[model samples]
Target: MTSKLTLSVFTAPSRPVNGPPAIPAPQGGWTWPPTAATLIAGEREAILVDTVPTVEDSRKLADWIEASGKELTTIYITHGHIDHYLGSSTLVDRFPRARLVATEAVARDIKTEAESGNDRDFYGQMFVDELCSTVIEPEVLADHRLELEGHDVIAVATGQSDVKDSSYIHVPDLSAVIVGDIAYNDVHPTLIGSDHESRLAWIQTLSQIQDLKPSIVVAAHRRSDATNNAEVLADTIAYLQKVDRFLPGNRLQCSSLSR
Candidate 1:
């Protein structure tokens, strides 16, 4: 088999904001823009980490994958979030043989969200209008280890970062781990559907990833260069400590003052 597939990362052009531009804040360095996709190209198969939100963005990725001459074997949805999985349909259309792989919890969440009709509306309203454009269904519900193109793929349930079924994909050969939305770099982490235990779970997951000591760690929403397994573990621990100190009472007090 010819090794034609090439792993590439790209960032989407920033969305245009309509409001008057405010003066830049002083002192601190500017943060890097969020990366849209992280691709893994193989000799005969390719895998994508997360799909971008829009058809246009997904199509761009699809076109590049197609041009590379490697078949897209799977799209690894690290969780049930729209930003990571909504563009899956686009990939399906482009590569008929490609499978959508997610944890069982992620698949169940998609089904539940679809049946409730809130998956589109709620995520669309919160994230972007493009997220509402497609309906996603996972074809492969990964409960344990999966062997693909001579690669040992394991989807271990990390539990509670962005979604309940949130996970990390480990590729031992590459010494790489694709951690979706589990850690954010240089940005305030977003907490959703979280409880104290889940928050702790997120921290533990980070520690576990550090133990793996992957050469590269890919996060769903941060620049590709922003993280490695060790750095993510340290940064996430620090972030959680801060969250622990700022209690619900503090939030309530702040809300009261604003009103």
Candidate 2:
């Protein structure tokens, strides 16, 4: 039997201002950019990966999914980062039948982070004008495979990429991978979530993905001009390489360099 798996990427680009203080308007008065909530849809049902940070962004994602004419069966979280799963609660409320699934480690990470109140203290203070809130840790999926309309979606559980307990969704039939914050295109990698040793490990993760020979790679956050291709992977590797070389010597930081 032939498998038909269709993919779509919905992004909420960053905004200039939010919350009470608005993050001090940045260096150039520019605000931080937005993130993505990727949708992997079959003919009859669909599975979503991750969610944006703010309630508004996530609610919009829920609306978009609701109108897609497919039953939302699963919301597969690749990781437990705030920007990745913060919107899951809103999504679950919107589509009650859609089960929120993640790795056991990821679930624990989500719970731990939620308990730390970073969702409110960090994201809430940075994004929403009012203090944004979050909830739900998602049901832990025992296995790594997702049967999306009978197509085998393999899970690549990467231990540390940007954050702990990261994973990627690989659709073999389509030669496509939904990489959640593992790789970025035409944007600076967040040095805050990753450091020297972890960045090296992330390079290896990207190498493993390269070995898959996927035709398309979806980054959780990306620039509008970037495309899903090997060039993006090369760009990410190059960025990390530069960081590895210069960061310890204090050559550069998160500033955008010539790419």
**Tens digit of per-residue lDDT, candidate 2, span 1-259:** 4547788878876754442342344464445555777788888889898887766777788889988888889898888777788778788888899988888888888888777886567665555343237668777788888898788877778877777668888988888888887888777777664567787887888888899888988888786556877666777888888888876534233442111
What lDDT tens digits, residue by residue, belong to model 1 across residues 1-259? 3333344665543332222125342233222235456677666677777777665677876887788787778787787766667778888888888877777777777667667767667545434225426656785554566555666666777776745568877777777777888876544566644556667777877888888888776666664445444576578678876776675323211110000
Candidate 2 deviant stretches above 4 angstroms: 1-3, 17-28, 128-132, 249-259
Q: State each candidate's clash count.
A: 0, 3
> In model 1, which regions exceed 4 Å deviation?
1-7, 13-35, 126-129, 193-195, 224-229, 248-259
- Superposition TM-score, candidate 2 onto the true structure: 0.88
Candidate 1 lDDT for residue 215: 74
Best by TM-score: 2
List the pairs of residues colliding in candidate 2: 14-33, 14-34, 19-129
